[model samples]
Target: DMNDIPPVFTTVPRPITLDDDVPIGTTVINLVAQDSDGTSPNNQ
Candidate 1:
């Protein structure tokens, strides 16, 4: 639909406190985005 909404962040990462000695390549958090449209391309 032309009025289709944009993808939203279904899973947002939370703030975290890391030590100064933490590894440089350490992963902080993960995020997820989802589209409500039920059609192809748009759903991706």
Candidate 2:
């Protein structure tokens, strides 16, 4: 049996404009990913 499963992203990421003087710790985007295999931790 194989324990390896690929991850999937249900939500699509949006594009945003950023300033050239943006801070170092600034967050551009937050992507949401999911796993089809419910048995794997990636789904959590």
Candidate 3:
């Protein structure tokens, strides 16, 4: 939910999936990320 820092981390497919046994079409996941620099990597 942020665009102010370097993308040091990433998530595959933009979205992931749960319900390993049965995917009933109502599955969900969390696309997460974190920056090496919390405030600003560019020192802005």
What is the C-alpha local distance difference test score of each model? 0.82, 0.71, 0.54
Point out where model 1 deviates above 4 Å: 1-6, 35-44
lDDT of 2 by residue, 1-44 (tens): 24456666777877799999999999888888765665645455
* TM-scores of the models, in the order given: 0.50, 0.54, 0.27
Instruction: After superposing candidate 2 on the true structure, give the runs of residues whose Cα lies further than 4 Å from its correct spot.
Output: 1-4, 37-44
Question: Model 3 — which ten-residue stretch has the worst lDDT?
Answer: 35-44
Clashing pairs in 1: none
Q: Of the candidates numbered 1 and 2, which has the greater lDDT value? A: 1
Which structure among the candidates has the greatest lDDT? 1
Q: In model 3, what is the error at residue 7, expressed in angstroms?
A: 3.1
User: 44, model 3: CA deviation in Å?
Assistant: 14
Give the clashing residue pairs of candidate 2, or none.
Answer: none
* TM-score, cand. 1 vs. native: 0.50
For this target, which candidate reaches the highest TM-score against the unseen true structure?
2
lDDT of 1 by residue, 1-44 (tens): 45388989988767889999999989878789888888877787
TM-score, ranked from best to worst = 2, 1, 3
